[model samples]
Target: MTDSIRHLSIHIDRTRDDVYAFASNPENLPAWALGLGGSIVREGDEWVASDAPMGRVTVAFVPPNDLGVLDHDVTLPDGEVFNNPLRVITDGTGSLVVFTLRRPAGATDAEFERDAEMVTADLARLKELLESA
Candidate 1:
């Protein structure tokens, strides 16, 4: 199985707490994420959401001003379930978010390319939000 990982980092002129609060809240996801819908509900330590490419996602980890992790079974348009791990970290000034997808051993290269573009655009939106907020 080839593990594909994509990294995106952007600097914003905002406090760490502000950035974290905005990004961590599921309600703000659609503001940055494309083609995502539904609200995020917190069940104990995990956050759940629907109408996403991923049927449901669980919050994996959330650390103060440092990191947050999310794990979920993501279904593509072709009905493929991809195990995705999303990690968010602060650069002590801004933040860097990465998405690592574990594809079925021989996944197509297009998969990585598509996700990279999507994630890059998401990061750009995040940067705009943080800078303008």
Candidate 2:
């Protein structure tokens, strides 16, 4: 029931566990997830992105698990919620990080493309950071 969905992926020269461990930590999000915000802090059970592009938002992540599922729900100040599907899977000796981006309802072509570009940049940043570590 969405306009479109795009699976953007990046191959990082790091183990799946290593990639997931770093990416799953909300504290490290600011280093790569620019689209999310410039910073995130845990407030009670949910992480709050005070400087998010869409303004202050609450990010609720799924419980940590061995499946490399990094799914999270981002709640905007207006109460609108966006579910982001993310996963890190083993790819040869490295990791393949995949982010599923769903186009917003009634979004224009340019908006969808911009979203995909942002996700791609974030993933690239993750790879660069992890590989350099």
Q: Rate the local accuracy (lDDT) of all candidates.
A: 0.61, 0.93
Question: lDDT by residue for model 2 over 1-133, one digit each (tens)?
Answer: 4459999999999999999999999999999999778889998988999999889999888999999999999899999999999999999999999999999888999999999999999999999999999
- TM-score (C-alpha) between model 1 and the true structure: 0.62
* Model 2 residue 82 lDDT score: 92
Error of 1 at 58 (Å): 3.4
Each model's backbone clash number: 0, 0
- Cα error, candidate 1, residue 114 (Å): 0.3
lDDT of 1 by residue, 1-133 (tens): 3355544555656655566677766668778865455565667765555566665544333344354554445445455555656655666765565556443456588876776677778878887977886
Top lDDT prediction, candidate number: 2
**Which predicted model would earn the best TM-score?**
2
Off by over 4 Å in 1: 1-3, 35-38, 43-45, 63-105
